[model samples]
Target: TPLHLNKVRDPDDQLVLLPHGLLRHHCCYPGCPEFLRDLRTENDLDAADAGKAGDVSESTRRNGLWQHLSPKTWYYARRSDAFLVPRVHRIARGVMDEAQTLHHFVDLTMRKLEEELRGRPAYAEIQEPWLKECVTALYGEYLGIMGV
Candidate 1:
């Protein structure tokens, strides 16, 4: 069965979908930093839009690459039935490893945040604002993780 992905919404609530053919085209290619940066910018725009809406629904947000898949396609993916062609798979595997590394960095950062906040007063109860400092620390950690 051919897979169909659901429409994914961008920051402006514009519907977008990476057609299956395009996925096949790019799957084998290593993702460039510029391409990833553009995607991040688009996601930031979506977040801004959602914030302005004041009641953003989950459906309006992109959930990473999975957002490109329709429910049925996602199901197939989960079942490991949706696979890239062999040559594409080899390329995609490297991409997947990179993605995993990125995710691990994020997880480590989250853990660092938790450790830093462990004994601190809860955000609501804090008398002094520490958000800026915490954000700076996290951003520094992120940059270090990215080796930038």
Candidate 2:
């Protein structure tokens, strides 16, 4: 019989099913697919949102190399995209390889804040204080727990 995965636990007792389609699946990005390679389960509807399934498989690759897949296209033949290239490199280096969706969302938010403040000398002058305030506003004691 095939191995079965039934339950995965998250912070808030969120339950994820197991290997519904494949044991694990990653992005189709050549440099970073599987960046978040979590175990997939049969009843896991999140698989679609996770960028897995009904797309290219390992066998059907372009130029014998892994490529990204979109719903409209398979094997997106190109170098890393400008927007996602940095994230790809980060995941590949295993520097920040945690699979928490909220964490990822927070990271993105912080990046956007920093980007907006870039090149503004006035903003830069108070960057640290402003950042602290923003963090406090959003997360109260959670920032302390996060060592912020």
Candidate 3:
């Protein structure tokens, strides 16, 4: 805790301190869990707008409450978590969420480019006439598309 996070040697190892999280003093700092109040549902009600008019029951709840069950309660919870985890991860990574596996084609394309280029290409300070012409043309086209 004595050393600052910015002093970390690895660039990628440093936390992505984007806003929302950056607005906070620390990420995931403990505070009161906000959820409270009550929820009430019953298996009896087919749907609220189903228009099956018989007398249904009223409801009441204290500190924390949940209805007994709904027909698709398990399915709802499953789908909810299916969305929530990835969202949390995406926010944590500053919107650069990655999947478990990179597609073979993308990997192959990148690898082929790497092999063809030998190492990172140095477009900056390009001395060769052909290479400088290519870079200038590419930039000219980019500026044209950008309407500059």
The model with the greatest lDDT is: 1
lDDT, residue 1, model 1: 9
lDDT of each: 0.34, 0.32, 0.28
What TM-score, computed on C-alpha atoms, does each candidate reach? 0.19, 0.20, 0.17
lDDT of 3 by residue, 1-148 (tens): 2025447535423333333222111222122132211122343123322434533331111111123222333332233121111122223222112312223323332333334444333222123344323322333333343345
Q: Which digits, one per residue and each the tens of the lDDT, describe model 1 over residues 1-148?
A: 0122223323333323232222311111123222221232366457656767785563345444433333334233222223311122232222332444545543443344444445643322222224223332434434443446
Model 1, C-alpha of 51: deviation from truth (Å): 2.2
- Model 2 poorest ten-residue lDDT run: 15-24
lDDT of 3: 0.28
- Top candidate on TM-score is 2
Give the lowest summed-lDDT range of ten residues in model 1: 20-29
Ranking of models by TM-score:
2, 1, 3
TM-score of decoy 3: 0.17
**Which regions of candidate 2 deviate over 4 angstroms?**
1-100, 125-133, 136-148
RMSD of each: 17.3, 15.0, 23.1
Model 1 superposed RMSD (Cα): 17.3
